[model samples]
Target: MKIKNLSLLVAMMGGAPAIALASGYHFGSQSVSAQGTAFASGAEAADASTIFYNPAGMSRLQGTQFSGGLTFVLPNSDYSDKGSTNYLKRPTGGGDGGSFAPDIVVAPSMYLTHQINDQITAGIGMFVPYGASLDYGGDWVGRYGLTKIDLMTININPSISFKLNDHHSFGFGVSAQYMNAELDKASDAVTGLRMGAAAGAFGPASSAITNLINAGAISGAGTIKIKGNDWGYGFNLGYMYTLDENTRFGIAYRSAISQKLRGSANWDFSGVNMTSAVPGRFRVQSTAG
Candidate 1:
C-alpha cells in the first residue's frame, strides 16, 4: 500500500503541464523520444532532450550529451462558405476560401547538456515554441476577418541543475523568446462610408460618399496590413526526486511572458478614388516595446 501511494504521489509531481503557454499556437513536441510517448516521460531522465522537458533530468546524465530532431507538419483545411456575413451582418459576397493552411512546415529542435561535476549539470536548448502560417487571399468571403496571417517564435533556454545527495534534484532555467508576425485583412470601404454618412463626418462631401457607393467603387477599396516583431523573457523551474533506482518523480513549470509589439500598419486604398481619399492609406508606426 505504501509503495502504491508513493508511486501515485511521484506520478503527480512529475507530470508537467500538458498544455503550453501559447496554447493553440504552441509546438509541444520538442523531444523526439518524449513525443513518442506523448511527452509523458518528463521524469525519465532520458537524454539531453530532457533539457526541454525536465531540466532536472540532466543531473542524471554523465559527460556531454546532445540531441537534435526535425518534425514535418502537413496541415490541410477547407473553408466551406455556408453563408458568411461581414461586421454589419450583411452577406459577404466573395469566393469560398480554399485550403488556407500550409502544405508543410518543418520544425527543428536542438539541445546540449554537459556535466560540470557529479552534483551539477548545465544545458541549453533551442526550439520553436509557437508558429503558424495561413493565406486566404484578398477576395475571400471572410477577407474582412482575416485574409492572411503568419506567426513564428523561437525560444532559447539555458538551464542548470543541482543534485542534493542521492535522492533529490532541482533545476532552474531562463528563457529568451523572440516572435514575429504579419497580419492582413480587407477593409470595407462601403461600410465605413455609410458610418461616416450617419455620423455626418462627410459634411458637405456626404454626396460624394453616396456616389462612390452607388458606383460600386467600394468593392475592393482598401486593405489593412500589420507587421511586427518583439522579444520577451521568462523562466522555468523543475524538481525531481528519486525513490529507489527504478522510480523517480518530476514536475516543471514555465512562467508566462508578455511582449508589446513594435511595428507599422499600412493601409492601401489604391482601388478607391485617390483625389477624395482622406490620406487614410498611409503608414502608421507604433513606438511600443
Candidate 2:
C-alpha cells in the first residue's frame, strides 16, 4: 500500500503519537539493580534479569534464580496552545490544552533462570519493553487531533544458554509478545459543517443535511474509538566473553516480529451509532523489533 494510505490506516487504528515523554514509547527500567549503574551491566550478568539483557550470561548464574521488580514512571507534561486554527481557518477556541497525559504509570517485570548443568542454563522472562498512554480533556482545543490513547505490550521470553568454554558462551531464545492498543478522538465539528454546506449547494437532500448541521441536530463533534490486540513471535541471540576476572563483554541481537492486529472501530456522533449497522472489523500488520 502507498505510504500515505498506510499512515492513515495506522492513525485510525490507534498508532502511537508523535510526541512522547519516553524514548519512542519504551519503558527501559527492566531491572532495578541495573538502574543504579545506568544499565551498564549487560556483561555483568549478576541477576536473573540477565535473561532479558543477555541470556548468555545465564550460564554464569548459580542454581535456580528469580528476580522481580516494579518501576513507577511519573511523567509530567502539558500542551500549550500558541494560536491554533481549524481546517476552515477559524480560531479554535478552548482553554489552553492542560495536562495532555496521565500523571503516573507503573511497569513491572520478572525473570527466572536455572542452571541445568555445568555448561547449560535455561531461563524465562516476562516484561513490558514498549508502551505509551496519553489522555487529553474532551473539550481541549486540539481534541480533534487526539483525546486519549493507550498502548501496552507484554513479552514472554524462553531461552537457553550453552557455555562453550570458561571465557565464551552463547544463548538463544524465542519470544511471544502480546500487544493491545486503544485510541479515542473527536471529529472536527466546524470542518464537517463547512463540508456539508458546500455539498448542499448542489442538491436538495444535501441541503437538508446542511440544515440539520446548522440547527445543531448534527453538531459534527463525533467521537471515534479504536481497539485492537495481537500476538507476535520473535527470537534473540547473545554472546558473552570474559576479558578478565572483573571485566567481560557481551553482545546481543533481537530479531523483528511482524504482527497482524484485528479489532473494531466504533463511531458515535451525538448518540448516532455508526458501527452498529456495519462490519466494524479492522486489520493492520506492523513490525516491531
Tens-digit lDDT track of model 2 for 201-282: 3255456555654555543355666677899999999999987878888999888988766676555445322233222333
Off by over 4 Å in 2: 1-24, 200-202, 208-220, 271-289
**Model 2 TM-score, all chains together:** 0.80
Best by TM-score: 1
Where does candidate 1 stray beyond 4 Å? 1-24, 217-219, 273-289
Q: TM-score each candidate.
A: 0.84, 0.80
- The CA lDDT at 28 in model 2 is 81
Best by lDDT: 1
Note the residue pairs that clash in candidate 1. Answer: 14-250
Clashes of 2: 0
Global fold similarity of model 1 (TM-score): 0.84
lDDT of 1 by residue, 41-147 (tens): 74587888888778888999999999888888888678788998754568878887788887888788999999999999999999998788888898888776778
